[model samples]
Target: MLPLPESLRPSAERLFADRLGLAERFASMLAEQGPERGLIGPREVERLWGRHILNCALMADAIDPSARTLADIGSGAGLPGVVLAIARPDLTVTLVETMQRRATWLEEVDAELGLGLEVVRARAEDLHGVRSFDVVTARAVAALDKLARWTFPLVADGGELLAMKGGSAAEEVDKAGKALAKLGGIDPRIEQYGVGEVEVPTTVVQVRRRAQGTRKGETRG
Candidate 1:
């Protein structure tokens, strides 16, 4: 199990309620998670409340107000996906995951909560159809370079890629430069945060997937 809230103090429960309004539902989901996964122990739930929920909500800073649909790849446990679904109901969130169990969990929760969402169970590459979204997001899924491949086609022209990266994201951005360019993403930028004591580092990675047939795909700084 993951660590509980990196820092749980006064006013945190309120944050949980505000940020994660459906705390009781989330707790119920967490209760079912480990047993469903068949790994049971003790992992602090508060930590997840702050680090995951609050941290995920921070992605909003990267998105354009025009964005209404978001695709969260590998949305295991629905950190950012579920959080976004609740926090921003205006967003038509698509939780794409290959794992059936996790997908079911996501689907069940969304259905139970009546949150507007579309859950797709398939490999990222296998996805087809007009699934273009305004924002494509991922957290702790793969390296940024590989992530470009994982997330590119899912984005429509003018959409953005929000990557939740760790400390020293600049190096990863450098490593992913070629990949992001190939995927028609540009103007990547980093944002730093601290979840209480733990550094909540991530990259907003504002990108405009260039229109096809354009000569210069990368958005100029």
Candidate 2:
């Protein structure tokens, strides 16, 4: 099993609980299939717990517990998608990757981890009218402007787009202002979470869609 930090153990135990076994299986998968499929760098295997798993899992704390549907776009290694599924069983997480290899790996991981997630092998733009979800997430996918363009259409009215960002979270939100508004997003804000847990808290650019009443007759952009 990958070495989890002592400080993170209790939280992991509580968050995972009955699914702890699935968590271990995921760690092993990242160390094994990850590098072989070029999902993660070879040197990253050792840092999987802190850098990948925890980094992604921390986003769970930022999401609303009541959200039922979540889509992770450009889910190369299922960073936040698979981790979120392992952390929150109530959420129906979908891993969306355009590449066949990554999508196939995600399907395999989903079945092995028994997370019961959906794997969609299509670009975000193609899924515009096909479906929508309560929450959409992406990590290191693209610049916020481009990300907004790609994902904003997939968010259901009254739902949210939670993009896991870094130091540039605020800047990206600023840059994405026009695109976000054009995509029917409102109330864009940067929220920093995981304080006291990870040295640097995870920063998320949370953008909420207009209320259904306000978005009447609005179609995907």
Candidate 3:
């Protein structure tokens, strides 16, 4: 199994605290079974700690302290979803994946780690109007414009959509502005976490859903 690098220990220790072992076990499973199951590329095994686990864990810092529930859409290999559940056990975490095999794998990981995650096998759009969450998240799922359409509705009024993005975060936010307005997403901004703690900081595009009673397409007049 690939070992967690010594260089990243400080950051890992800080993000996970007492639950670091759970994160380690999850990484071990990813390194061992991820490639075979097509959940992750074999090349990713080498950097599983820095590139995947820690990267996801850093997002926990951006979560609202009052948040009680979160849903991770397209939680393939359980990236931020499983990682966040391990880090912040206070919040109820749900892993939503459209693929059957991936959903099954998430369920297995949830049971093995006893993380108590809700594994839902369906497209995010399918859950719209049926269920919602205090916070909704997605990583490498889709472009911001299309992603907003799929994820925004799942965010409860006054809740947030925290999308883990890459360097293009700003561009995506700019491009999704109109769609965001239509979806009642407000205060869109790019926030970075683990700036000094990690080699590469995690970029998150955060948007809050405007409260209901305000029409979707209505202007603030």
Which candidate wins on TM-score? 3
Candidate 2 positional error at 147, Å: 0.4
**TM-scores for every predicted model:** 0.80, 0.93, 0.95
TM-score pick, better of 2 and 3: 3
Q: Supply the TM-score for candidate 2.
A: 0.93
Tens-digit lDDT string for candidate 1 (1-221): 33244354332343344544464466456655745563223463445555565567666556678888899999988867877776666789999988898888888888777776789998778764557888889988888888888788888877788888776577888998988887778677776643343345334555568765556734422
Screening candidate 2 with a backbone cut-off below 3 angstroms (N, C-alpha, C), the clashing residue pairs are: none
Writing each residue's lDDT as its tens digit, candidate 3 over 1-221 gives 46779999998888889998899899999999999999999998998898789989988988889999999999999998999999999999989999999999999998899998999999998899999999999999999999999999999988899999998999999999999998899889999998888888899999988877866654332
In candidate 3, position 214 carries an lDDT of: 67
Give the deviation of candidate 1 from the true structure as CA RMSD: 4.0
Best candidate per lDDT, number?
3
In model 1, which regions exceed 4 Å deviation?
1-20, 31-41, 128-130, 193-203, 212-221
What does the lDDT come to for candidate 2? 0.86
Q: Where is the poorest 10-residue window by lDDT in model 3?
A: 212-221
User: Arrange candidates by lDDT, highest first: which order?
Assistant: 3, 2, 1
Model 3 TM-score relative to the real fold: 0.95
Lowest summed lDDT across 10 adjacent residues in model 1 is found at 6-15
Q: Residues 19-125, candidate 2: write the lDDT tens digits.
A: 86788789888898889899999999987876778778878887887799999999999898999898888999888999999999999998787789999998999
